[model samples]
Target chain A: SQQGEEDPQALSIQEGENATMNCSYKTSINNLQWYRQNSGRGLVHLILIRSNEREKHSGRLRVTLDTSKKSSSLLITASRAADTASYFCAPLTQGGSEKLVFGKGTKLTVNP
Target chain B: DAGVTQSPTHLIKTRGQQVTLRCSPKSGHDTVSWYQQALGQGPQFIFQYYEEEERQRGNFPDRFSGHQFPNYSSELNVNALLLGDSALYLCASSLFRGGRYEQYFGPGTRLTVT
Candidate 1:
């Protein structure tokens, strides 16, 4: 079973606009990580937010974790056409060796 | 530094046949994990290898097995493959500290079981 579920299964936006996707999980997690997958490729690590941290930033990406809600969100500011890809949120399980369980993912399309 | 690398970027096989995929971890990393991703779906954990041993695995059946070499490279073997087995196989490498959990991924091998 998937530990997390992301909302807005698909999102379409114009370049330079901001794209935000949210994920909700069922169990407690030690940390949450976000990844991006281009078409026909493996995933690329984006950012990671530990349970203790509320927010993190890297370049045009921003992520926030709310442990109380067991949810997290990824924000891509000033999106580019190249930013088009699928975004996934994977939460590390608390017990059982810290393996990650992924959500169904949100597909984002940035139109030029 | 080279990131994780996988072999046979793409492959096609008939159902019931066997297939083996390989992966070399990223430089300086020691742990390796495998994932299977179907079309339009998120990747699912297959198993993880560390120290030349199977450490943890996902819900996959016994047909899915793996081996890790001393150099930290690994192989994922699927026996009696099914049409459902077709998917992208991804290999990720990471270092296991006490509680850290960051993993780097390879470009992935696209497997199509016809």
Candidate 2:
């Protein structure tokens, strides 16, 4: 299964604190994407890290990828209550056209 | 610009009935994909359509099918629905830039099979 297995099935933190989630996959990938889903609604794409890239930052979000370990991590800084949601990671395999195989995502809660 | 949009935000149908869900991709997107997300589970890919034809499929059964229109819109149809078919149906769209592109998801249509 090439599904990206997210770690820390659930996490709780205070507003202004940072939250981190990890994902591990079983196969090589071209890139990894992180998304946030609020209350089980539509998912909002957060960031994407290519295989050659080690780290990338977008506003308050930071993503790191370690292809050697077949793992990736997403970090949200200065979290707000609105950040409370399920975070999913999709390890996109090479040659597959957006056929994302997702694993159970990490649920994060930010207490205001 | 509008993102992906799905119709019939919610639906309720009895087992053995058929249901059709619709989706319109974001502007300029040429590919459409469908997924099923059960309660408390990650979304599972059903199939993907490009150029109005199924370019790739997941492990889903034939009972789960889809079509893409020339205008880049798509529809997902399930025949003889089962209780287990109740889930959040999500439609995503993206441009097939060779292979790598971000998918914009719709709000999804929640289906209940009773």
Candidate 3:
């Protein structure tokens, strides 16, 4: 059992629809981050939300953090075919070396 | 400015052999971290180096070692590789503030062990 766990292993949706991904962690954290990986490519950081922060937004992405529940969510509004990729949630532990522990991730496919 | 960069995009190694993977941190980022990602799995933290010191390590064995230079470049050396050692080695770099940072990752090096 790693620090983070994400559900909905795979999702398929039409273009212009919204996509939501959820992640739950075992312990408290300093911050949580989301990343995107296209096929056969390195991951790209999408956004970060500190523990003290409940919600944050960037572009079409909205992230929410529930510290008491040890869970977080990422929402992509009006997702496009270009947004198709695997998304992961990383929870940075409170006492660790500032390294990020990632979840398995959710595979998102937005059909054109 | 250039993002994080790694060398030898793909490599093949045999069991019990040694492999060295190199990484150059992003501009202005002084900390380097490494991870191993197997097929269909998320990246697992291996270790992190900052200021030419091993700041933190994950649950990996001693066969996995790393070194950081004064210029914020890093090298990951794995010895006595097993078949399970085959994976994508990723290097991420970020500025070490008082606490943590959001990492920027390199394209990664794929290591296949026979």
Candidate 4:
């Protein structure tokens, strides 16, 4: 299935505190992507980490991929109130069909 | 450039009724994909359209179908709706060439069935 299931379905943190979320997938993937959704709105793409790459960063977001464990983690540094949202990870399977498999996401709450 | 766009922000229907949702892909993108997201869950891929054809599909049933127009717009039609069918229907657009996997999502159309 290659579905990326996130751990700790929910998390609460204070403003300026860092929040980390973990995701584990079922199969090998070409790349893993992270997305954030505010409330029930559309998902905003955060970052994409390729299979060969161990880590990638975008602004306050840091993503690390461990293909050996078929898992990935997203770290948000100095999170603000605006960072409160539902985070999702998508694992894109290698070869064959190129559809993304997503799991139930991790809901993050950043208190001001 | 404008990102992906969807029509009918919210919809209400009764069981056994039919509903159709629409989406317009991002500029210069030729592929569109549809997903169904239940409350508190992630989006589930329904199907994908590329070159005006269904290229790949998920585990959804035939009751859920879609079409892509020549202008890169798409429509999702569901027949014989059920209470379980109520969800946020999301449409995403991406370039299908060169194995690009990044997608731009539209503010989903929230559907509620009674």
Highest-DockQ candidate: 2
List, residue by residue over A1-112, the lDDT tens digit for candidate 3. Answer: 2467888899999999999999998888888889998876788999989989999999999999999999999999999999999999988865334788777899999999
- List ranges where model 1 is wrong by over 4 Å: A95-97
Whichever of 2 and 3 has more lDDT, that candidate is 2
lDDT of 4: 0.92
lDDT of 1 at A59: 99
The candidate, 1 or 4, that scores higher on DockQ is 4
lDDT at B113 for candidate 4?
97
Give Cα-based local distance difference scores for all models.
0.89, 0.91, 0.90, 0.92
RMSD of candidate 4 to the truth, in angstroms, is 1.4
Whichever of 2 and 4 has more DockQ, that candidate is 2
Tens digits of per-residue lDDT, candidate 1, B39-64, equal 99989999999999998899999999
A105 in model 4: Cα distance from truth in Å? 0.7
Q: Model 2 in CAPRI terms: which quality?
A: medium
User: Roughly what TM-score does model 3 have, to 2 decimal places?
Assistant: 0.94
Candidate 2: the clashing residue pairs are none
lDDT (tens digit, per residue) of candidate 2 on A20-94: 999999888888999889985988888989899999999999999999999999999999999999999998876
Winner on lDDT between 2 and 4 is: 4
